[model samples]
Target: MRHAGRALACLALLSSLAVAAPAAAQDDGVAPLPDDFLWGVSSSGFQSEGNGPDSNWLRYTEEQEDKEDVGASVDFRHRYAEDIALAADMGVEVYRFGIEWARVEPAPGAWDQAELAYYDDVVRHVLDAGMTPMITLNHWVHPGWVADQGGWRSEETLRDFTAYAESIVERYAGLGVMWVTFNEPTLYVYHEIDNGAATWLDAPWLFDRLARAHSAAYDFIHEADPGAMVTSNLAFIPLTPWLFDAAFIDRIAHELDFVGIDYYMGVSLDNLTAARTLTGGLADAQPDGIYYALRYYANKFPDLPLYIVENGMATHDGAARPDGLSRAEFIEDHVYWLQRAREDGIDVIGYNYWSITDNYEWGSYTPRFGLYTVDVQGDPSLTRVPTSGVDAYAAVIADGGVPAGYDPVVPESVCSLIDPPLSCLVPAS
Candidate 1:
């Protein structure tokens, strides 16, 4: 482990970066990120693509009384051209989306060519739009057949998932695509247990299965597409990264080419507002925690690059956030910290905003996190309305990042537990 000298090395790198990197705008603070830094948008197959497939999430929504029905969510399956165009218009360089397992393989060992071709069209469209495709193999939804065969509980799941990953990678290899073996595997385990798919006693076994799946997939993805970047993104649970990352990320750290972090909210000693995520309510925003998240991962995996796989604020039904934070401000605030992270010598390479349009958020359509907001339940047409975030994001991408001298809309929290003692002792500039 190179941790012994990491702190001093990081300090030295910070000083060197200050003198070496040129500022894009105002010189005192935030500097322009590298020209090759990836700016992208993200969406998952299950959440954005309407026309339901037989899957665990569909069943979860149907069986649970409180869960809202996911009826033709934003109809991305039919309207992807418009959606991709919207993202391309924003000048994004990457388009990250999932290839739905349930939709592609409805039955065990059976692949649907039509569904596969639909994804082919989507990828080709993205390429035509000049965005690199980032394909996620699994995003918390598997075929109902897989779910019926014990889901992640049985050891058999590991083998089946690896096979599924191999098939997908073979199809998309050499297409200049980035691969995410599994999306937020830790949260995948949480949702499985939370939805009664598994029990608390089965948590460790589930984690092991996911870790094994990712490790196996990593080898094959690289075998098929040499020099490919592969990772299973982790949802950054502020203040308790160890609690969340321990079982999953620790198990597959060596296999990762880059650290993929999905950060949304932060919690402090005085503010436990992040609890809202548990109840499907909009979590209170803490933009500065993003800086700590990057710093933490950079310190732990000093040799690997970092990517913000997903980061965006959520609103309830297009309503103003209770904290009065707009999506536009959220984008600027987070990007400002990203620039700061890079200036401090973090090997940060890319960022993908959570989504292109609002869709069914897990079991409910209440929380909206999209650059172009959509009224999933109320509007039959599913029109994509441009939010203030659209203009803000376009400007951010055009300028290479938030303007220099830019400060976050929400100030850093006191004694934030994002990185505990280190974060509290040495607050970021």
Candidate 2:
């Protein structure tokens, strides 16, 4: 295993170099957000709309007691209309959601027309609600046939993914939907590698294959839906420089029409000296870190229209953070930073909170990042309870931005040194 200290230091150095560069030179900050900025919310089929389909993740959660068995996650499969209605009420112009590959392709060479009809209905609903549908081609789930055929590790899997991508885009060509070829491809590869669920391919090779798959899908999507924009969303992890491969970026750069960045936690390489570091410290959790992280990617991919495709703070069981950073405060803090990024000339076209409601978070239901919390374990009705953040987000969507001078309402002492400097700070109330 790599030494954590050494790993973090290298990450910090890269981050410093990235930040020191001029944003304009980086090809970011040149374009203002287009009038059609796709402010939106995001959800995955397996994670949010729980309708059992015998996925590897489902089996993993059920077989492992330590993992949270998300049997009936917000039940979006049954309640998409209600959930999407909530999103429409927020005045968001887009709804980014995934169509599970496993559900559509339950067996090899056998596609379910009903599955396509379901998504067609959902996509139509989104359009009817006055929101564009941004569909993710694959959100880390594969058909059982592929899983049985050694998954993405197999060379055949790459061909399968390409075929799958081509089929879906061709099927839904005229829906006026935007397409995300893949969601967090790096994380998906990492998860498969770390969990021993896949073999025969390492990270580098997996990335190479993914790059090919994305490139192929990119062309197909454009050919299928000439008006559609396409990209492969990247999971941004600041201070983990090794996680980034410039060569891979170069390869996919031509293939992408825009950049989808999923910024979450922040880390600094200078763990010992920096006030904020990723090493189990309060600073690691501060929302300003998100701003810096976005700026970093904005600089990295200067010419591309950037969308914060996934971002949200997690709380233990939807409980308030010790620092008094409630869900509302978290949303405000992140939004303030987002506005700052925009003012600085980042071509940020959209923002999608990780989820509209709490769902199965990989293995655990405890770390809730939802605007509405779902009783995953206890409630038979599985009601979605609105968090304090729900009203805040609704207001943000209505205004098309965070209220001017919005800052977290919590006391500075709670965040200690990690709190934003009060010099230009203004309260949102």
Candidate 3:
């Protein structure tokens, strides 16, 4: 393919990046990122929507303890204009949000006009705010009708999903928004299994359905608007990335216009805390993990552009991190590595902080990963409080990144397993 050769050429030109090489070793501050870089934040539907319609997650929330459903979560469902204004004010050029299938298609063949109009306003507001909208078609929540029909396990589910994609793409084609066919497909399956929607044995069958759905959606989206970008964001598990990729990326590689990576933490011999977060603690983080994730994918899929679709720190309910890292410090540290990845000849075109405001995190709203922390359960006002990250990210957007020679607040760890065999051998000093 055209990109295969480009990937090889990039690898040859950037072999020095094989080590933890900084481009601005002698510079004053970190170098400015490319002018065209896409800077943004993201949110999902079920997680942020308070008065959500019937879906698998809504049902799951009812069955579990410590699982309380707070209405309208920061009220993004109604207050998206305020939120979009907030992101626009920060100077971010993109806002990635989901268009929930459950909300759109309440039943198998029925599509709601008002719900579609609501999203129409949301996308319009995003563009009006000077931010490009990255719209996700499915973000782990499907209509209860689909859930009842065996979710991803049934062939009927894929057919209905493709129809949903078609309707959405045809409706939004004029907006020319970047499209995410599915948000984190690996985790989608994992959640399905975890939520008891499917069994472990159903993974392969589900993947098969998801792959087809994505490919079909990719085609459908393009046919509607050829200029639109389409991809399925992958959650890059720091430890066994190959395992994760095999589970999904390899299956739908050709259909992707770019690689959307949501990298949160890294795994290292010393940084086993990511394991804690992976299991549910959401406590551990390696700020520089973005570099490793980008490098791995750039080399693996050289031809395709890479987008840091989701990357942010999670704290325990808006509390200061136990690591004593401020969100400002955290943002700077991560952005530094993002600049490093770009300097290494990786075609990283965009970066989005995981969320615009805090919302429900799967089972609980305890682990907060928002630039603006909203206390869903504790605060009645549902105030969107700007963390240190808000100003820090704003500064990054304004300056195109930190200044030249600006270093991370935290340095790369020795024996870092973020890149496996190579990272352990040629660790950053």
Clashes of each: 0, 3, 11
Q: TM-score of predicted model 1?
A: 0.93
Pick the winner on TM-score between candidates 1 and 2: 1
lDDT of 3: 0.84
Off by over 4 Å in 1: 1-27, 278-280
Which whole-number lDDT from 0 to 100 does residue 93 have in model 3?
A: 93
> Against the hidden true structure, what lDDT does model 1 obtain?
0.86
lDDT of 2 by residue, 1-429 (tens): 545654454355455543322232222212223456677899989998786686667767777777877777888888899889988887878898899888888877788888878888898899999998999988888776787777776799899888888888888898888888878887788778766776544667787888899889988888878988888888765544334635255569877778887876643332212343334223335565555555555655677877888988777786566556677777776776666667666677788987888888788778788887887888888887888878988777666556554544522222212112211121111
Candidate 3 lDDT tens digits, 11-91? 554565642343434345446789999998999988886889988888888877767765667789888999999999999
Clashing residue pairs in candidate 1 (N, C-alpha, C atoms within 3 angstroms): none
Of candidate 3, the 10-residue stretch with the lowest lDDT total is 18-27
| Superposed model 3: Cα runs more than 4 Å off | 1-29, 427-429
| TM-score for each of the candidates | 0.93, 0.83, 0.93
Identify the leading candidate in terms of lDDT: 1
lDDT ranking from best candidate downward = 1, 3, 2
RMSD of each: 3.8, 6.4, 3.8
